[model samples]
Target: MRFVAKRQKEGVNVSDTHPLVEASTLIVGLAAIFAIIAVALIFVVELALYFVSAEDEANLFGDWLPDDLITVAPNDERLYQTQLLVDRLASHWPGAPYTFRVEIDDSEIANAMALPGGLIIVTQGLLNQVESENELAFVLGHELGHFRNRDHIRALGRGIVLSMFFAVVTGNDAAGIGIKAADITLRGFSRRQETRADEFGLGLVHSEYGHVDESWRLFERWNIDGSSFLDLVTYLSTHPETGDRIADMKRHAELERWPVDGEITDLSW
Candidate 1:
């Protein structure tokens, strides 16, 4: 005898979960995985940085810098004075791997950047903003702190990891987006690094001058209310707000009982 055909149950072919729900779950899982791998890679990079000597860093990155910058003349009084400060601070850093040098870039941007090796690029605008040696020491110490912690290499390694991950996932089509994404992701890390550097710099300032003195004033001078468009943008930037950093340093000094007041040293150059 022939068997009768039977009707399929309603919704038997469909999954119990909604399509959107499945999609959302998959997306969240993937994101969690990606985050884990990225964090692991970052941790690996940080660990590797410990093994890479500072001399190795200088050798690797020294030539990447431009040699043609209109660096202040070695004989220039201002340059000489700045170098003197560097030498003094560096003396406190016994067994320092690199001999630090400050190069004054003839730019109006009020910024100081730590380059690979011991080179520090200080903008003329930053110098113009300086009111005293203590202020300048704070800036220099901040850069030195970057070097002490090997932040440049840490950042570079983290960027490479993000870029590579994105390039592989996106078939190299979304590398720019990947970089921007990395920058945004790394902003918090960068801010912490900046804060730590501030502390390191503050210590150097105190050690060299016997008082923390005017170090925090550099940030105080740059303090801006978040009302302006540009000022608001700073919230998203890598460095912490200048005012917040100043407050942090003051709090730090108070905790350490480091003297914040002393005779202000004038910058003759």
Candidate 2:
């Protein structure tokens, strides 16, 4: 009887958890499992990227990227600015193995990106938004860092893998859907990766311009137009928060005793 009573007590205790508590526990466990999976996948991507050459990654995906940049004339002001930035920013990268290129897309989204094959695309909106060439240098150098670390290629591989997996699971998305998925995925990266790129960019800016001024203005102005909670979250999830970036940048500048304030060179033709 004592043994039976003890067994019953143990079973009762096991079932005593509130329904809500059990539900919460299940949710947390699933979330943890998902987090672990995501981290593992990113680690795998990082390892794969280490072995893949930047040029090869570029060649694999370079042919398919939507080249809206090709529409603008080579001498167009935005295009010219992009070319000059490539020369000013990318030239300083010593023993750089990959060829660097920049193109300007006619858009108001205020964005830029680097493709695997040393292609950098700057939007017209980004050109208009920046207050100075120094700001532009920071932006370009940040993208360049993506190339140096081959993060762009890692992102490219992730997108392709996910899109293919989704297609296999759903068996519904068409080829166009896959293409769009790739574009969307390329737009995001892990926050740690982005911060490293910022460091790379800021270091390059210091090397070239001898100082950084008004770097915060680049992000502040963009957010001023009202970065919504969702947009802010979405952007920050992959890139460090704007305030954090500015704060770190200032700390580095102070440590290096780099120039804090200087003349704002116009970002123009």
Candidate 3:
């Protein structure tokens, strides 16, 4: 009877703790549910911010240059030349939604920029510096390569998402986070993306002009002109460093077995 009583007491003790076990299980389940909800909310917020940023960029640039003004030319000859180059390159892509335009900024700063939605602007200074149609094609093709990969959009989206994340965590303003995010996005493109664009651009030049080497030659000329600072700024503000980019281009050229010739298109028209 004593032994039976001890066994019965042990069983009662275990039964008494069952409610605690159930409470613990309930707590864990609630925690898991909360975690999942938090993650889903974060993802939805990130996606929404990304699209918002893209729309904002589109609107900001739209105010300056409306969609109708895309084809407005500062000079007819330059516009015609730009159109020709864009057509040739677009043919290479075979279905890319690319619209090419030359925005003749009289700022005397030799620069070219590729924006989202296939908007490309080549400064008068840059146009005046190039020697041949092929060189121009190479440069324009690089910009087109950016467009095809949607780098601008990706960069903008990334910036927005990251900025929003930062702002949420740090309690900073949206505008402050945005500037930081943009700075981060432009420091370096994803290696895979950059390589893909480089190869695609190189192939376009090769297929069109039979000059696979033109891409590197153009960089070499830019390097010779002591444009490293501008290149650095571009890498920080728009793309990657020129030296690193050239190296990547060279690697791809070797992989594709493209011939190495010092022949460069003269831009001194």
Candidate 4:
């Protein structure tokens, strides 16, 4: 009994498994648990969002625009013309839940992003890159597509999931072990979502215009062939390869029998 007590005091026998193997198994298990919790939470968030009215979404995120962004005045010529284009596009989707608003960010970043409640922000750099009204329309349509599909809300839910995951796992050194793997998975998901948005945008462009001309011109600048850093890390990117995206758009247009050529409208601004 004394020997048994001494052994008990010494703690349970060392695991037969190698220490490294045991640690790895423990880390993998914890990571799996975190992943499961995150997925469940995200599912709950999505279900909750379904019951939340569009008006409620607008009310919740109406003033959520970044404070650091300097938006062009509503009366600015560029802003005015862009708003008109958005209005024209919105007309095509009369069933959309929220009233669309356009804001031009006074920055050089060549990008556009959709926000909750039908807010679309385009950087000045994107405006600089745009060569025609049809190209610009495609961009706007893509953002509108995000709104139509509620991608922005899903993105918000994903962010919340990540935050909750990190909150629960942060203290342990192993917390960071799963981040890169998770990021790669999320990026793949994002790339697919972007492709869907692109497809939707192409359809909208075809619907609005008699043909789908110049809809893919916005991606032309990046349609180079080379094995650069970007190529090496394509899998890690949230966006798909620009050249492939353009090719896919062309193929889709072909399948739909949409004319790829038409009169391109110059941007008024």
What would the per-residue lDDT of candidate 1 be over residues 97-172, giving only the tens digit for each residue?
A: 8878777877665677787778887877778878999999998998899999888677677668876776677754
* Residue lDDT tens for model 2, 1-269: 35444433456546778999987776666545444544456678878877877767666655554644544577787677667777777778986757776777766656778776777887776776677888888988989989888877777766665655555537543334443433344444556678788878887887787777876677766466575444445446456678878878788778878887777787676
Candidate 1 ranges with C-alpha deviation above 4 Å: 1-30, 59-77, 165-184, 224-236
Query: Where in model 3 is the C-alpha error above 4 Å?
Result: 1-73, 158-182, 190-192, 227-236, 262-269
Residues forming the 10-long window of minimal summed lDDT in candidate 2 = 173-182
The whole-model lDDT of each prediction reads 0.77, 0.70, 0.61, 0.77
Clashing pairs in 3: 130-267, 131-266, 131-267, 131-268, 132-266
TM-scores of all predicted structures: 0.76, 0.74, 0.61, 0.82
Models sorted by lDDT, best on top: 1, 4, 2, 3
Model 2 alpha-carbon drift over 4 Å, by segment: 1-22, 58-64, 67-74, 158-189, 222-238
Candidate 3 local lDDT, 1-269, one digit each (tens) = 35443433456545655787887775666545434544454456456546655445445555354344334355567767676777877798875644455465553445666676456777666676666777677777777776776665555555555555555547534334334433443343455566676777787887776667556655567666675456435433454556777888888878887765645555422
Query: On lDDT, who's better, 1 or 3?
Result: 1
